[model samples]
Target chain A: MPPKSTKSNQSTGVTSPSGYLLTCDPPMKQFIINLNDKKSADKKFILEDLDATHLLIKGDVRDEITRKVDEWMDENVFSTIERVGENLDTS
Target chain B: MHQNWEQKISSYFSCSQVQNVLVMPAPSKRKRAGDASSTASKVGRSSADSSASSAANTATQAASELTKIDPQEELLSTSKSLFEYLERLPPGTLRSIYNLPPPGGATVAAAVLRSSSLTDIARQCALRLVACGGKFKVGSIVEKWIQRHGQRDALLALRRLESMGILEPLGLANRPGQGNDDIDDEANDSEKRAKLMAKIACLTPEFKGAMKLHLSTMSSSPWPTIAREQIEEFKKSGGGAKSDGGEKESRDPPAPYELELYTQSSWDSVLHFLVGSDEAGKDKGGVEEPPEVMIQFLTRIGLMQEDPDYNGADRSRAPLVITSKGYEFMLRDTNAQVWQFVLQYLNSLAHHNMKDAIRMEALSFLICLGSCRVGEGYFNSVLQSKSARILMKDLARFGLLFVCRVAGKKAFYPTRVAVNLVASNEKEGSRQTDAIGQSVAATRSLEESLSAPVPSRSHLAVVVQTNFQVVAYTTSKLHISTLALFCDVESYRRLPNVIFFHITRDSIRSAFRLGVKADQILRFLHVHAHPMLRNGDHQLVPSNVTDQILLWDRERRRVVMDEVWAHQCRDSSEFAAVGQYASDLDALAWGNAHTNKLYVHFGKSEMVYAYIRKWRTKHYNS
Candidate 1:
């Protein structure tokens, strides 16, 4: 699961930061395609680069491509955050 | 009404996840915003934009020179704005909003409003998403919401998205709602503002997680001044192996890697990460490459040669894949070694903007920096706030710090090599004298370490004083030749890592010409000189000698090349290719552009040699 935020604030015309959104990775594009396949059940959507891999979302069961892909792309392309963290409290 | 709306807005969007989602503006609109922001890099925007009624276009020339140099001033001011959004973003919705659809669809307005305005009616929308996670048409999602409720409700819903890290974060001293908004009089100190600005100066990028992932995947390094902590860990772990830097991770109990040679695949990953980024496909979705690759690489070709039970590899057992020793070494201080390589690699690629491929490396880099003991008094909360994961990863991937594993976590140990990556590392520079004194003391200790030796025994000062008619210290041949390069040699021989030489006018001139100005060289000598010269007259190296050296260097030209790897191609790019990928064993070579540095590390010695010698008859001298 993605790490949850603590406090929330008021509205401003803020937009998602592009640098954070499209971090520019080859696997990100493919990860989205693989994420959308509902029937594949491979749930394993992998983003690989260098000698490291950031995440592997299990999306093998879905066959329809777009939503699954969008969902995976939502988390993977924009971040490489893993489960382990500092100052993180998981109760 | 505006205040009430703002309050209602805050209340509606108080959920962190909703705040996170609202942070992202609609995708199409942001693309335009990105372009407007890019111009900020070129032009100097006034700092008054926060309260200003309209955007000012104040970029001119001539007397506006200082303004031009202060180019990123706008970026600086906006840093606060961005940070708040990320901080305020409601948890789950933050990432969702950032992932807005790429245009086109029914319910576009609803999806826009619902997702964007999540904070205001987040539960309602989340209920909608739970109601229609897969079936809702995005554009229609917005239209449907407005149709159900009225435009007032829709506008409020839309306003919800505004709370997420959407609008570029302005440089507010604190998160919008975190600080006291009523600081009207007493606390209005410029000093406090300066502290706030300093805290801001040290603030990590709002998208620190992405930045780390970006650097890690892209294989970039941190700036030179900020040494990757991983490297420091390596040094501590290597030399201080007897003692723990702090704590060691328990993931893999310390074990020795028993390998004879590195398999081509594992070796490449290690080298590539070190050289900059790990290879494509090999990183395995790791922050970069797994530590296993480092052990495998080192075991295969390094210090393991001394292992008594080493049987290279059982070509018959597993073929020459990876030896056990290789695995152990990598696990030993793998994070640090990787950091050292990345820092050097990033230093090499300093000229390029981060590419996506090496982000994992950068992430690993930052993890190593942040890995250091946390909540310790080493860096205050303010400095931590400023850099955190963002600068750390970027700096580490580029090999700014020597990173190592500590307390089951990655830790950073900085090195002095990368010069500009320093993020106020010393903590308090408020007292200039203290800062200078700290530096001087550090230098003194460093010089002493070099002189406190065994065997061949030669001090750099003795070597410099040779031409000044003094018997010098030092037995290292490498040092002798290096000294001879600029100082006149009274005596020396290039036998190996040892030698002896006297500093002379010609060499002094050369040294001065090569950037070791007379004063600096003299200072170096004074600091490291035989303890006897501490109180001696100013005739340390002799002003006459220094003058003559400066005179000699007058006509000499010192060339510096800023070299970097331009592109990577299969070494066999010369071969005709219909459609064949080079097998893992194929020898890979790189194309390089050495900008102004005069030396290149030799393939065989792994030592930097004058490029002129390596290039032979190449196109031209740098």
Candidate 2:
């Protein structure tokens, strides 16, 4: 079993700051997705359908998606700091 | 008159106009052309030749005297001295100077300055050169502009210039002679040209103000400036930077840490899929349909293999497994990992005959995404470009971006992977590596990450005990799956959060079969070993277990499994002929002359088979 994220880490409510993780399993929102291509017309996809591995998030998930990307950037910076520290130690 | 000429020369060759001077060939080359005109004068009738020769002799003496003047000192003291000397030459001599290789420096400088894609570091390096002193060593320029940028990055930038033919390393002249006159002459000419180029690069001031202005524009405003009114409208509509709680904050939005974390998982899942330990059923209840486009892309790159049993028509039923290529890819750092995958993707597209422009647009889009800020909606604006939109859709398949389409309106957000690529391109430099430059400031963190190798331990939550027992503190399925490669998971505990595993000889051999090296496994353990176990030195894991694991892995080397296709011929002569053909292709793996049989590597067997079939048909027909 994977270790459980703490209550704070477990994004529970959509409105909660910590709960706003894109990876968090949020409630399914009914949204109409119109494929930008010529082939597909307006169709329905749940928020879950826009999972990260095969993401197709459309409408209203803008804040959620932005929040997710921001988190990724922060992690990148954090890892960078860690790497720099390790290099310093080794040198 | 000499003093007045010197002042005119000095004023013209001021530091501010150094760019023009640098781009322009040295006064020495211009003097040589003047020498050419003097030769032309000497080529007339006897009396005329005699007078012309004497006149030319005096001119030669004057030119020689000018040459004796220390060029560096003259240029440094009075910028106009060199230009003044050039001015003294007849207009006919100017053509030869013009005929010389058009100043390579100014064009490169202009390109560097005007380039929207040039990284801040590269731009700064260019700016510094344009503002450099007339007399300076190559080492000094490198020290002043490049060293602090990062040693690897500096080398990459220099290499980039060398590849572009804008700068040539001084060492090329020192290489042993090719012994061919033409080659030697070319080398000599290039050496002279490079020296002149270096001088020009050192003193150029032509683009200094322009570069400074460009840098200031980059610093003051980025892409947002292009669509400034749109941004104002966005802010007016309360769609600007969001606060931590998804509210419109009075302050700028906090960095989107969660999105980055999501990006990490998204990328990790793709990696997990490659290694066969994806946390599918255990976490997500059931394995969702594998991302088909992503799988197809990986298959095309030969990183993942589709099930042999599945036909091309059945998309969902095609089971995919990680190839040996994928196994090696898992061990690389994220930048290298992403690079190899993207490179392979591009190569595969090229192989399939995709137009160069489309491939280039795909590449530029990736770099642009990397340069853009994490939370910005700039990705959507870039999608307005058709080729970029197509590329973004493919990028979403790679988990580099998440596309949102609502009622035919599409917006895309670049993931951390996409952003990392921007840093990768700039840090790596050179077209061979792929060049992608963004505004300098936006890429500072990305640059640091790209230039420095990230420690794998930072993500590890494992501990290897002296007794060969392994305990991991995290729930990341990826970690557990990786551990399962060389350790037997003895138990999974809940309360304090730990998974216990025992390293065994069999498990070690199993990992070796999967193309995992002894050192790789040891490094993994060493990186994951608990803080308490790390103790003074770098040897975190116990020496006994590490050595035993390596020995176990090595033991598998005794018998090699070579996959080959055996072919038998009717006669020894035929067998020998076919075998020779196979050997020529380097496909012949083994042969038994006694049995008139030969074996070829599976990968090359088809070609050998075709040749054999053709020879057999021709012989029988004849």
Candidate 3:
């Protein structure tokens, strides 16, 4: 017999925790989780890890989370303008 | 009332010194009036005999009073009587009389009227009327004119003369019960009045004097003289015979079917460029690129725009991308699309400060083309004005005409496209055969054969599956490119006769950004669905795919961010109480007892706060 399926064991609740629900890709969720771990005591932004793509976070820290995500994106992403500049430099 | 006007007209003529001019034609005019009285009796008549006797007496008296008078004085008296007769008529009657159709059913007369300018055809008709002694029965002149030059141009000339007040209708009496009439009766009354007005007409003496002045100043024969001379000069230079290498071939014009093919191909090339098909940019497909001016015009009208990424030294050489307007234009039937281009051309003429005379010539020439028999070659030399010649060439570029040069003599044949340019969209499909005298079934088959290379008609060309797979059964580069507008290129698979692509979320989103609506894409697919799909008892382009496409479009606009206040509670009981209270106020956005938190909508945060304070006081007091 196959091992018991974990699908039935997963929680299926109608009610959700009240917070600012943030939905994003799995990588972005991981990034947010890492950011929450780095925060000092009593300054935790996330209230619950809802799923791989969702996070229930403190409403007061929403602006701070957005700023951090935008900063990370600016550093990680290669924009069209920057790519064009790099190509010009190589040429 | 009928006898009163007749007697007054005779008396007026008898007293005037110009009676000689009227007396010479009195007997003939009396006979004509006698003939008309038979038809006039149908409306209402007490006694035809009495009216005949009265008219006969006036004619005899006018004959007795006949005397040679000065031409100038004669013209003045004639003008006075003409104006007097016109003034005596009711304004409504006068308007209906003007609205009457000319004798030979000139359908193009309405367009000529809108242009509000006289054309060469109208001028020729005026000259013919003047030459025929300045007075003739409306039917005879129109019949004679139609017999010689065809019916299409005759009424345009006649209508223009009437509008200019040079030609006046004489016998249209106001109907008896016109005042208390319903719409249907009024329409019938107008038709009857129009029939009566078609009886007889005469030139006003003021116009005759002007014509005399015009004639005295003219150096050559007023009509066709310049055209004849130009042709003669051209022939003398061996332009007609030697250029085509054979005299016989030079004289024979291309058939209407051939002209249609030529026009269709040229027009397809223009559409191809608008769709940004590879064929339009390359010569491999033998697609003739539309003229540079036309391309510029497309950009100016916002149907196309220079690609922002194409940064070339020559801006004119930059690649063009179609705009939303262009896609909308492509969705319309060919007839409507052509008319739009023609109207835009007319507007551009005004914008460029073209002279009014040249503009009128171009306008009348376009209207004339609408009335021309398809495949019939009109001599280019007939267009004496340089501007008209240039307009003809431009129209040729637009695929409205097929211009062929035989020996240096250019003769432009109006294609079916040009002939139906002014036809309304509803009538275009049915009336196509009327232009070329072909059967409807034959024309449809011929059209399909000619249009094989381009999916111009609403023929079955697309097969869409419930899996979001789209297969277009066309090899035309234009059709393929258009399909790519909202189809995933990464999934594009090409076959000899079919091209397969998928409708992906990203592709549809990009199309939405380009301003194409989800419904338009669905409608496009449905309109071009495969015949097999249509015959089956199933929706074209499965409902699921259409729904998903629409859902994707809505998804882009679905996620709306709004500010809200999160309320934290100490316990589950407190959370339940606050949540219930906020719910009663219809301001609770979210609530969870486990976390003991409640979220209030931002707009109602103050209301919730006051409630929470009141609740706290009551609980603490308890």
Highest DockQ scorer: 3
TM-score of each: 0.26, 0.43, 0.42
Give me the candidate number with maximum lDDT.
3
lDDT of 2 by residue, B315-335 (tens): 433566777677666654455
Candidate 2 B-chain TM-score: 0.47
Alpha carbon deviation, residue A82, candidate 2 (Å): 33
> Residue B602 deviation, candidate 1, in Å?
40
Better of 2 and 3 by TM-score: 2
Q: Candidates ranked by TM-score, best first?
A: 2, 3, 1
Ten residues in a row with the worst lDDT in model 3 chain A? A81-90
Q: How well is each residue in B1-622 modelled by candidate 1, as lDDT tens digits?
A: 3333323222221211111222112232234334544322211111111212212122111113222423223232222212222234342333332332211111122222222224555335434443332233323534465466643343333233334432222233232334343233212565653443232111112222232233244322222222346435556565435345565432221111101001112233343332223232222322223232122223223312223443645221221222333322232222223333433332222222331112223322332333232112122121232223334433332344333444334444343222211222223123211221133333354356345555322233343342354334544332343345454464333322234444554555455544455444544444334444444544556566566555445423221112111112122321212012111113112112222111111221111112212332232233
> Compared with the true structure, what per-residue lDDT tens digits does model 1 show for residues A10-76?
0121212111111123554445444444335454333221212222222332233334444443353
Angstrom error of the Cα, residue B182, model 3: value is: 23
Candidate 3 docking class: incorrect
